[model samples]
Target chain A: MSNEQDSVSDILEDNTYKYGFTTDVESETFAKGLNEDVIRAISKKKEEPQFMLDFRLKAFAKWKTMKEPEWPNVHYPKIDFQNISYYSAPKQKKKLQSLDEVDPEVMRTFEKLGIPLDEQKKLANVAVDAVFDSVSVATTHKKKLMEVGIIFCPISEALKEYPELVEEYLGTVVPVGDNYYAALNSAVFTDGSFVYIPPDTISPMEISTYFRINTEETGQFERTLIICAENSYVSYLEGCTAPQFDTNQLHAAVVELVTMENAEIKYSTVQNWYAGDKETGKGGIYNFVTKRGKCQGDNSKISWTQVETGSAITWKYPSCILQGDNTTGEFYSVALTNGHMQADTGTKMIHLGKNTRSSIISKGISADYSSNSYRGQVKVGKNASNARNYSQCDSMLVGDKCSAHTFPYIETANSSVQVEHEAATSKISEEQLFYFESRGISRENAIEAVISGFCKEVFKQLPMEFAVEAQKLLTLKLEDSVG
Target chain B: MLEIKDLHAGFDGNEIVKGISLTINKGEIHAVMGPNGSGKSTLAKILSGHPSYEATSGEILFEGKNLLEMEAEKRSLAGIFMGFQYPVEVPGVNNAEFLRMAHNARRVSAGEEEIDPLDFDDLLSEKMKTLGMEKKYKERNLNDGFSGGEKKKNEILQMAILEPKLSILDETDSGLDIDALRVVAEGVNKLRTENNALILITHYQRLLDYIKPDFVHVLSNGKIVKSGDKALALELESQGYDWVTTAN
Candidate 1:
């Protein structure tokens, strides 16, 4: 028994989150609290146009009138919005024209995170927009992307360079008053990626945004928007990580995508935020995100594939609206929770167009004392004749102490719609482990094989490089989960 | 190559393989026949280092090494293979990939380079051909949705890939049709060599008809009651196990 105890401790010690170290750099952060003055100051700091400020003011008013919903399957202490600094950014002297002008300390941080932003080390065929705290530091492959009539830059830069496009499609999909966190994000969101693909042209390379949260007490509010014009296609990737802190940090981000006629937008995210301490669960990120895409034109498609493996309490549902005839919407996700983490995530497919089709495949893995839930909704409007939806949510438990739940809601206004939902819960039994061990495979490798197999469908939807990273990340996170 | 002395093991504090002693050597095939609840499966499990079975007071030496002290995977890496009566189905894990991982584990332990997937595919194809298995089994998940016969054949397929020095087949003939049993038995026979040993645990002598064993032992109440050559199996099949238990 003592030897068993020692081995368990060894596993726990070796499984510490690797990206918990904070980078020491000079930063300028706003005072703790949210008010009209803070919003005005944020706009003034970026020299935003009047309409942008008015948009913030309207969102703030709506946010003040709304209350944080208490419906998610997660429990935590009340968040003191007044105690959070809504804006934080690394202090920079002047605008930079190249990675050379960026701070070396910040550059080293991204490099350590395996996302090199410098010219010599930048990833080939993939442009990156590296965001630290509340601002985007550097964007790679801007010239090459610009050659094809593509606009890939930070939202702050887009606000100045292409304000017309931003205003035209900013909150069209997810309105300002969509939800509590989304409304708050709309009010004080600092920086995120902005992508615009032109008509009849496919982007030459993948566009990615790597977000890192460094400041301890400041909340991260990032708003990302991607728009695909007629007959165009684009695939975007997002990766996020935060430094470990004893006090939980809030990260409320909103991502919206719009696809026009004969266009498609594929969005993938591999979120590995700090999930607090595994024992006491004292600190981690409180991720409350709202992401949705709209298929606004005939024959358009929108797909969301996410691998969520972090955050102490994750409440997110990346959804889609099939608004045009013959449109398609897909959501493939693999969310894993360990330690004292809790995640309630899934997707929503609203079919309003004739012959629209949607599919949802979500895999949730829970270990330790975590709680994982899959909540999804499939709705078909009266006019959506021949609408179809298929959803399958599977949950795998690593130990007896963890739990899994599924809540699926379906509504159909017309009798012609077809909807299907399937859910299964399974445990990684001792027998299964023994079977692998008796075959010469170590327990760690066995768990890796089983988990990677479980996530294969969702992983296949990710980009090539991102799928590899997601596999490795899942393996590392589940090291100490099994006995 | 293998020796067990006064092996006393069981799960949940209930002694099942009580006071069992047996010795197996290279190039020899031993058939341990027994009735239901006579500890046939328990002995096989204890030999392979199953976690649930605790060896209370006994010693198992595999090539002069303390087999009881090794973990289940370590025992496997040390060249011991157990063909389960009920092979576990691992969904979503490709069968060929699982075989490759098992094979590579042995190679890495012997300080040899791991076989790449392309080369492994060739090896697997050849092994499957010898077993009369279809190529689709290579792409399917490990035993997921496989029939009983298919599962048994898969066990033999793994044996061919791992190439263990000592193999224990626990009731491998059960639940297998005549055709599958013949294919599986033939597969096992082809892998037998002078440097490797085999132990077949069975309730009936039907399997011994295909692959003749050099030695036969009858177990009752966790102890070997009788030991003989191939004639013993035929005699037991004819006269039944009651006579052997009464005589012992």
Candidate 2:
């Protein structure tokens, strides 16, 4: 078994990053660098409304006063903001009427990514909005979604077709001054998915988006906002990957979800960014994202489930703000880091209303020169009487060379509130490996089975198809680790 | 069914099994009895292709093939089964699922169709019944929180599921209570067939009273000092291991 594991590691060490190829689709790319003028150019290029331009200006001005945060447990070379192109778009000559009108090269890339854009074979009950680089290339199942009074489309298109709706809810949850990365995303985010489930109606299909960063020397900043009206329910999923490069690419995304009275929102992410070469860590994606959902009305619920396996350096925290009485919030995550990858991720649950409840389950796996950290906080305000929170963070270290850390903060002002936190760290025991191998399971399969067991709780929270995909994605990322 | 030729196995740098020769025919139960550190367990581990315990020299023949050349998983598919004394807990792997996978892996190797989950669950429940196990044991993580007796019973269940040609039980009776010992022995008794063989490595003659070995071998200082029929086990139990060690 040990010999089998060593051979796998050797093969992975000599292999290249699988998703590191370029797609030659003609795109309208902007000049590199950022400034007030560049921000204005992006706003004009999108043909934005005056209020939209004002929103960008306010976020850009706030972003200038902020410093890059260094408190996360991940380490990376300083990002030169001046070196990155702020905006890049796949140039479509005209409005595409159908899937065939889209660029075939980019379409083929999606096929390789296992996202069959063809409507007939598209994942059942899923409405997809494919975003390439800085713009949404196609939106599928739009008519069906529209018929049910649900609005699902690119945020770019939403700003034009329904500016009043976009203007009312854009920054209501995550304002421009939320964080360093959130401010930058609000200022320059080119495109992402927008979902609105109307009051009293459950969305017939899950809303999904496939985000790809194609152009080199460019930064991708996408903003996603999902609003569930009073007494409604919705499920949203986002998957991301980027072409590998020798230089680290910047990806700062902001996702905000708002649920009203008796409404529920389920959001999931499978992040598979390019994690540079195994040796030297010369290139990869610098993923610094801020995701937060607000349970604003009584009896509302918001749940976040993420499977993060890529990114050379990841510093993201998907959080929830319980602001209404009897609101419920949950965060389930599985973050795997291998081969020089570093991730600092978890979630925050803040309770401000009476009887609010939250639960967080995080599983972190580190293998082969990787470092994974889980940092989270749960706070109950003075008025939040009887608020409850339960948090569990389990870390699995695959090899001796990797590292895992956990940090938890809990604050309660009301004595009536309850908070329970449990954490455990373990190594993949040699005994377990030998046991599986002796039972006729190959070493690779043994490792995969162990990991899948470790992350089962989090995977159960994802949609059925995505749960399987997340498992397969985790196996692909941790294929090289062993005893 | 199995042959070991002057086996010279060791761990790290120290030689544990200096040199030993053994053979067993189908339908036979051979008891390898020894005091602590007599290399009985190490011999069982080596037969199952343990990564540690290098076979410094000598050869092992399973049926007609060189068993030493096969990987651990391949040897398992080749009908070798080892019941561990202290089976490690795999916290998230479902017990029934693990059994089905091992069963299918062997079936696939022999060009047989894999059993479906429904059929597997029914078959597993029937086997668990034979071992006096609850149906809920199938839903649990493999031996994650099992009692000592339960872990040993799980090994028996695995052996029953695989129905291997050769089985080496390494001190399986160490932690069993009287009741569990009876159940486990009964389970093993049901698995014996003319085409299969069993090697029971034990510290006492108590287990042989239930399962009944065809031959008894006394091991001292990594070598088999005496080989006899079942009567020798009762004699060793009454005389104590000191007599055997001193005699060698």
Chain A TM-score across all models, in listed order = 0.98, 0.97
TM-score of chain B of each: 0.98, 0.97
Displacement of the residue A433 alpha carbon in candidate 1, Å: 2.6
Poorest stretch of ten by lDDT in candidate 2 chain B: B128-137
- Fraction of native contacts in model 1? 0.70
State the DockQ, from 0 to 1, for candidate 1.
Answer: 0.60
Highest-scoring model, lDDT:
1
Tens digits of per-residue lDDT, candidate 2, A1-483, equal 245556766757644556778899888888888998998998898888999889999999999999989899988777889999988887776778888888889888888887878777676788889999899988889999999899999998999998998999999889998889999998998999889899998999889999999998889999898999999999899999899788899999999999999999999999999988777777899999999999999999999999998999999999999999999999999999988999999999999999999999999999889999999999999999999999999999887999999999898999999899999887777678889878888766787788888998999999998998888778766766665
The lDDT per prediction is 0.93, 0.89
Q: Looking at model 1 chain A, report the run of 10 residues with the lowest lDDT sum.
A: A1-10
- Candidate 2: tens digits of C-alpha lDDT, residues B1-248: 78889998878877888789998889899999999999898898889888876788888999979888888899899899999999999888899888998898888888999998899888998888877778778889899989999999899999999999999999999988999999999999998999999999999999999999999999988889889999999999999988888987
User: A42-150, model 1: which lDDT tens digit per residue?
Assistant: 9999889888999999999999999998999999999999999988988887787677878899999999999999999999989999999999999999999999999
User: Could you tell me the TM-score of chain A in candidate 2?
Assistant: 0.97
Q: Which stretches of candidate 2 lie over 4 Å from their true place?
A: A1-17, A119-121, B177-179, B235-248
Residues forming the 10-long window of minimal summed lDDT in candidate 2 chain A: A1-10
